[model samples]
Target: MGDWLRLTYFNGSLWRRFLIDYLFGIVVNNICAVVVAFVILPGDPFFHCWVFSMCIGSLVMWMADGCRILIWQGGRPSLPGLLGIFVVTIPVGYFGGSYLAAKLLALPVEAVLNRQIEHASPLLIMILIVCVFFAWFNWSQSELSELRAKAETEKAHMAAVERQAMQAQLQLLQAQIEPHMLFNTLANLQGLIALDAPRAQYMLDKLIHYLRASLSSSRAETTTLAHEFELMHAYLELMSVRMGARLTYSLTLPPELERFAIPPMLLQPLVENAIKHGLESKIEGGRVEVVAKRDDKRLKISVADDGLGLETGNGVHYPNHGTGLGVANVRERLRALHGDAASLTLEPNTPQGAIATLTLPYEP
Candidate 1:
């Protein structure tokens, strides 16, 4: 409650604002006092005019700032409101300050008025000077407020433009992934058709099922872990038909994490990489295991395969040693989406083959 009153309601400390107002009041009143001393009261002492001007200016500044804080909540008031404040403040400040100044100087209030009237009437001249100063102050404040509002609008526009550009890049990367998987599968299917007819027909059926599941997921930005695991099962089954006994796979998805959201096809490329790069070229192909688990505040997923290890039959990695198209695509997408909070790393799996691990912050 104290914070609300002192900070939130006033948009800052009220005492600090009061000090600033009073400081400005002193400067303005000094200028007015000098003008009155020279032009209106040439014979009277300058010190007397200075005292009276200070008292009146301080009172007027206090009243004006108080009204602004209470009614407009520290925001700029309308022109009518600004004029009304001056209308009310001038009379009250003049009468109150006259009385106060006279008491301070040890004289009757009537004596101060009589002396002012003896010269060219300093009261009317002081009022004119104050009006001009305040009018300029309010105009400058209005322009500053407009400039601030324009800057905020431009900042929002730039953020929206940046968001749109990032989305477009994500879509373009996803577009590259779909065709890469499709062409590779089709090439394998063509080879199988000439070597084995019945097996090729079975593979075609599996491909139909795989495509149905994958086509929808490929178009989406995010999917549940359950759907992703299900898609992986279909894909592995299709690949198994082509590789015969050479390909073996397992998918482990915890029930608690089934509904968790991940970018669509985020795991598919990793699984494809494990099989194509780690196992396919070897005479005795090995197993591919895809596991998902939560670790502290992060999600950890690993695609491990026991096959020919990092080096293929030719001693060089398939597609480009462990950082192939699939790895590069996944890495780039992860970086774009999560910046430094997410990561993808390749390491040698225990005993044999390779492991691709993805780590990202877990959000429930």
Candidate 2:
């Protein structure tokens, strides 16, 4: 449809445009006046034709230039400026085009050709042209203004819709994590009660504290770097109790990088994944390490563990989806939020094990 409109509106192939201007628009309109002149007075055909062309074509020129100046000079000017230019420019176009027409057509003189008395003054017709142009110009301006305002309104509405959708999705992710985490903690506490009643009670208290802290922070979509790291530590303590020190860990964080902002629970899933996939498969023991550092314009966090890494079957590195839940969720969240400014990469650790590293924009 757009292509068709362009083809239709811009169809005047050079010479066709010239013909429309001089022959169709200019010549045809004057021919009517020329016919009128012939009926009024019966002498001097040459004089009548020349007078008719000059008087009529001048008005055409006025309308053409007036439209251009009003619509095309970047923007329309004030009423006074427009009226000033219009009044002065119309007469100039009238006389100038008349002079050119006479010279080109080999008329003997460029002056008004007839001695006929004025039936209507040319000035009155000029005023009528101004009134017509103003009517058209005002209507066009009003339409353009409405279109621009509507476009802005639509743009703002779209932005608000996008923001609401984002917030809802973030809340949903948090909601999913909370119940899953609570169930896991309960499982750990139940096993502890069968073995050591005192330790089970301690674990219950810690679990309660963790839930309390989570409830306080639940309303916020983002948290301070220090708070997220603290949450990571608490989750690891529960995992440590469940695994019986089979998954020893280390956290090496630089001191000054603890004030940045990041999405809550963003790191917990990645850490959980490292333990679930990389450490749980091993029989003897392994360690998962959390390393955090601040680069010039980014915050880098890594979760690494020593155990079976990316699963290999039939010589293909196929991920174990049963244990890859947290890793997949973190990757999706990072991409949806930060675009290309953030990155999550999973690769082999030094000798054996999987390492997941996240590089995020450090918002202070």
Candidate 3:
């Protein structure tokens, strides 16, 4: 109720509407108020005297408040709503009743005429201004409600877009890891069979264990740091069987980082990239060193291999490099999971091989 009234005096530019609506209601009311006085004045002072009194009073108030109707129906008040506001009560009740009122009170027609001439005063003008402010109050509240509804609709739309974007990123990350891991494990198994059948069987078992973990975690971006390491350990053992005495690897993790959370299969890609492109291409074979540590609020991991390093691996696609899938998949996953909070980088190790390093926020 209060809100509708406030909206009437809105937009300083629409003052004309306010004035017109107000004048219409009061003009109609005064016409009726006169009829009332005419009938009750005993036909002595007839319509002449009746019109003189309330005609001005009704007009003043009608002009003051008719804008109230426009506000009630929202900023753009309908013609019908405006018409209804004044028509419903003025002509049928107040104006017609004024004549009846005079007789009931025993006031002569002359007395009513004198009343109108002196009625409007300084205080009445002040009262009229107060009423205009009251109407403006109701209009403002209604506009706020409309604005709130619009904002909520926009928020819902944006949330939907964000959800779809994240899902697409996760899918891309998962796809990159699978085939890359499969080919690397196959290469390791092939090398093992030529030397020792029994050891090759053990290598196959570790391969299966690591792949199972990867597949199991495919649907999730997050996995425990410990689970990720366990996968890495199994894969490194498979490589050990194939490399003979010419190749070796090590996994080192800080005590405090043991329970931190990270994306699944993140380190596997870098290690595989190091082995296939960084070390296997070299004449002397190599040592792949894997390290994980927490520095302040971030988790850092590095895979370094002593072999002919980065120059041989440049521009080689992940799917083509046998195990390059790990690098590409982890990269995509990092961007998706943390925006720019995590990154994977590659550079040549101190003197001999390539080093791939990953930095990610430490989530306890």
lDDT per residue for candidate 3 within 40-122, as digits (tens), equals: 33354545444433443454445424444444433533457544644453333333344555665576856653553354343
Pull out the clashing pairs in model 1: none
All candidates: TM-score: 0.66, 0.59, 0.57
Kindly give the stretch of ten consecutive residues in candidate 2 with the minimal lDDT sum. Answer: 110-119
Score candidate 1 by TM-score against the native. Answer: 0.66
Clashes of 2: 0
CA shift at 224, candidate 2, in angstroms? 2.6
lDDT of 2 at 220: 84
Q: How close is candidate 3 to the true structure, as a TM-score?
A: 0.57
In model 2, the runs with Cα more than 4 Å from the true position are: 1-135, 294-298, 311-323, 362-364
Best by lDDT: 1
lDDT of 1 at 164: 83
Candidate 3, position 298, lDDT:
85
Q: What's model 2's overall lDDT? A: 0.66
Better model by lDDT: candidate 1 vs candidate 2: 1
